[model samples]
Target: MDCHPRGRGRGRGGRGNRNEESRDVRLSKSLSYALRHGANKMGLQMNSDGFVFVEELLAHQQFRSFSLEDVERVVATNDKQRFKLCNHPEDGRLQIRANQGHSVKVTDLELRAVALDDPDYPREAVHGSYMKHWPSIRSQGISRMNRTHIHLAPGLPGEGGVISGMRQSCDLAVYIDVAKAMSDGIQFFWSENGVLLTPGDAAGMLAPCYFSQAQRLKPSPCEIELH
Candidate 1:
């Protein structure tokens, strides 16, 4: 799905929240933290495909007070579509998993690569990041770092400005040469929200030269600037 991103952070476009909306935002972040980075500590075990039983997840002490309805509400309303719920292939039990951008280990999320020549492959892609990291990224290329894959957003080539769906922490947009990267053997995957993911190169990371251009963005005056 071409879902837009949502969060308590900036860049996510939303107005003042009602009590229910506030709770959903809070719950969504909590879910991301637990599933993508702290499943073990959250007392849940995800199978190789990065899936955990929804019932098991809700049973955790942190989530025990929340009902299945609450979980479903958050998933349904989440703008980013970060979490996905599906039926377990083996049984009929409901399961949940983070779509991509995982920092913690997940054995087999099954994110395979798409060819550069694929019709839907974006001509240009953008990576959101802080300006502080630009120098290193320019020299070494984008890395997944602790995450499972490098997260990217699709944009049109020759687009002169920042595209949508950037993270609040980002002040810079790095444009990627998707076709060139793929031709150079870098593989790309699509997340549930249409975010692009790549496994990088043989060294397990993207090289600096693959980044075609970058630009720093100014925040809107209405944005609540955070230090």
Candidate 2:
């Protein structure tokens, strides 16, 4: 249910204005799910560059409130495969598998938690692709930007995966009650994308930054709140 703002993959006229009917359907379903199964708690983490906030809906409080038993009944123990079409990154490894377009390359993977307090949250969602990297960004440019784009689960009973462009643009869905989050006193910020409103700022969103120590340029400014 990775609903987009209808501008996905339309950079410089890729598909700008060419809306897809199926995409619309998917967006609708995702919105419905987010709203229906509102989350209560959020997970936030900090880093050297910025804040990384994970809604923690998949395995945290959101799941607990929605029916922890259900989540426990379905999700895998490791929860590693929760995200779909993962790839083992390598240097200049673009076309490494059959599903290349869906396989994004990345180094120094990290996670964050975002609070989901208000009910209005998980509704005022931002739509776009995110495949953010530092070195790749420097060498490739905006055209080579990869971030979260599509969420594919097939609704096959117990499988969900957030997919994006190779090595970057790995899309994910975060349910947040913006109004309530501010009121409850919690925020996990990355770079000022100017997509948010209060304690925030834009819509020209950036990539899903990956902050790691093992990999150079593993994504700086990737921070999140501790509490």
Candidate 3:
């Protein structure tokens, strides 16, 4: 569930207080764990699209105590926009799912592609990684590992794409050639928030040759910064 923390506020004139931040962090972790990798064990039945009924989620042991309002707030306020709350078209019931970052074998979200005509469609993308993994990545390419798809970050003209694999220890960013990748028959899917998702090989993932550039960045050295 690509459930990374994004800065947010709790109310007018205030960022999230410690209590609110702690609560959200705990809830986000649990939700990501359950929905992305353990829905069946949790007794939450996800549809082919990875959506589970809101009622089912609320009834699940892990989240039975959380109100619908609480769930909605978490989904809406998530920085990465990882989870989505939607209305089930057929049943008209409220449903929710992790937008991407799934490891379980389920139907793909089959998200729509941003039209090339669209102003926000990205022509290039960025992926964050670490130097230590470069040898493997160069030789075998970026594999999905155990995850369902290879995630990519596509920032707007002046913005930076969200870098994965660079948190805490990663120190490199790889630039992607979106047009070239597409020309070679690689397909890319953009989530609701613009993160790119690729239907990678079931057994492996993208090959390193698809990446056009890799550069290292200095990691923060302060003890406080490391934490």
Candidate 4:
């Protein structure tokens, strides 16, 4: 899943002016793009864990106008908590990484493996998509595409403990049979932000057979039988 933070403006009584808020949003998007998908393309040296030195990142041309504090602000104030800042393993200097939703091959992330028998396993897992893509999805199954994993939400938006998985504007919700998929040897992992992720089969495709049901959530709510 290539999830990026929604650029949310500050509240009326929040810190910083409109200009600062705009800058923060711009910086957040740039960081999201680089850390999740383009660190290598951007020539930033990221470790296997997906961390890049804050200093090195600041030196990039796109961030010349930004500062370390700006990065900290973005991380601290992000509504979804998409980015993480921590000290480098080799040195005391600070580094940053995307929490999840990486297109890059990040080997190490704080993901908890969810077994079928896990007591806390989600009762429902859904992937949100649009009606326009339902035909292709129904035929080809859900593909991770360029992302490392296919992202699923444990529950819909506004539900308790649900955040950062599916988009709010999504009209279709494909419910996955998590227990059935796990019983069939498909691995499921829970990200730090509560997103359910799976690498799928060897080909990285979650076939329609694993989909328990599909529902049209917008304009109206109705069940769709997958053929």
What TM-score do all the candidates reach, one by one?
Answer: 0.79, 0.17, 0.77, 0.89
Per-candidate Cα lDDT values, in order, are 0.71, 0.25, 0.68, 0.85
Deviating ranges (above 4 Å) for candidate 2: 1-41, 46-61, 76-81, 84-107, 110-227
lDDT, residue 225, candidate 4: 73
| Backbone N/Cα/C clashes per model | 0, 41, 1, 0
Q: What is the C-alpha RMSD of each candidate to the true structure, in Å?
A: 7.1, 21.1, 6.5, 4.5
Which stretches of model 1 miss by more than 4 angstroms?
Answer: 1-17, 110-112, 156-165, 220-227
Residue-level lDDT of model 4, residues 27-95, one tens digit each, is 999999999999999899998888898899999998999877778778878767788888755566788
User: Which scores greater on lDDT, model 2 or model 4?
Assistant: 4
lDDT of 1 by residue, 52-88 (tens): 8889988888777666776776766665667877776
TM-score of 4: 0.89
The residue pairs that clash in candidate 4, if any, are none
Best by TM-score: 4
Q: What is the lDDT of residue 162 in candidate 2?
A: 24
lDDT at 137 for candidate 2? 33
Worst 10 residues of 4 by lDDT: 1-10
